[model samples]
Target: MKKPMKAALLSAFIFPGVGHFLLKKYIPGVILAGAAFAGLYFLIAKSVETALQITEKIQSGEIQFDAATISELVSGQTAGAESQLLDIALAVLLVSWLIGIADSYRVGRAQDKNVDASD
Candidate 1:
């Protein structure tokens, strides 16, 4: 609705930090998006790698996956506490992106809504 918000939203459509760029909050937006990217990358690739390794082991009769989960999707099997933080990072990025866009828009809107306010 506002310029900043619009920009932030548009930026999110590109990556997750574009909104921050539009809002002029470069540092936090970058950190948030970078962290999200790292998390998502590890989650997808790590899970796929783990699955492949497990599959090979099973084929060779060397190891077997647990019975608790059968899907073997990419969302699971990514270990480490940093990864756990990925979820939070992703959330922060999304929220920050949205806020940046929204705030920018609102700020611009407030400054310009009145056609005669600045005269």
Candidate 2:
């Protein structure tokens, strides 16, 4: 397969910055990987916080230990500023992933062209 396609596939299937790393584009690879990881961290943190809150409520008898109630609580928690932050985190993750794939492919293609020209 072509270098560009290979790079794109690596980014898409492995991780957001894997392709850049493969292409020896260390700076972009680090940036993309960092952003993706930051987004994931925020998402996981929010989930854990929500779970703790629900658990506390359940333990306190404020909410029943049922699927419906838990679901409702989870939905309720995702509102206002918190929800907005979560949305932003999700967007960042997605955008970073996409940019990583496209930019890596472009860089790889350019490198391939350079190699061909030099040959």
Question: Which candidate leads in lDDT?
Answer: 2
Predicted structure 2, TM vs. truth: 0.94
Q: Candidate 2 clash total?
A: 0
Over 4 Å off in model 1, which ranges? 61-119
RMSD of 2: 1.1
lDDT of 1 by residue, 8-47 (tens): 5665566656655666667856775675576567556655
Q: By summed lDDT, which 10 consecutive residues of candidate 1 come out lowest? A: 68-77
- The estimated TM-scores of all candidates read 0.49, 0.94
RMSD in angstroms between candidate 1 and the native structure over all alpha carbons: 4.9
Task: Give per-residue lDDT, candidate 2, residue 79.
Answer: 86
Clashes per candidate (backbone, < 3 Å): 9, 0
Off by over 4 Å in 2: none
Query: Each prediction's Cα lDDT score?
Result: 0.61, 0.94
lDDT of 2 by residue, 1-119 (tens): 99899999999998899999999999999999999999999999999999999999999999889999899889989988989999999999999999999999999999999999999
Worst 10 residues of 2 by lDDT: 72-81
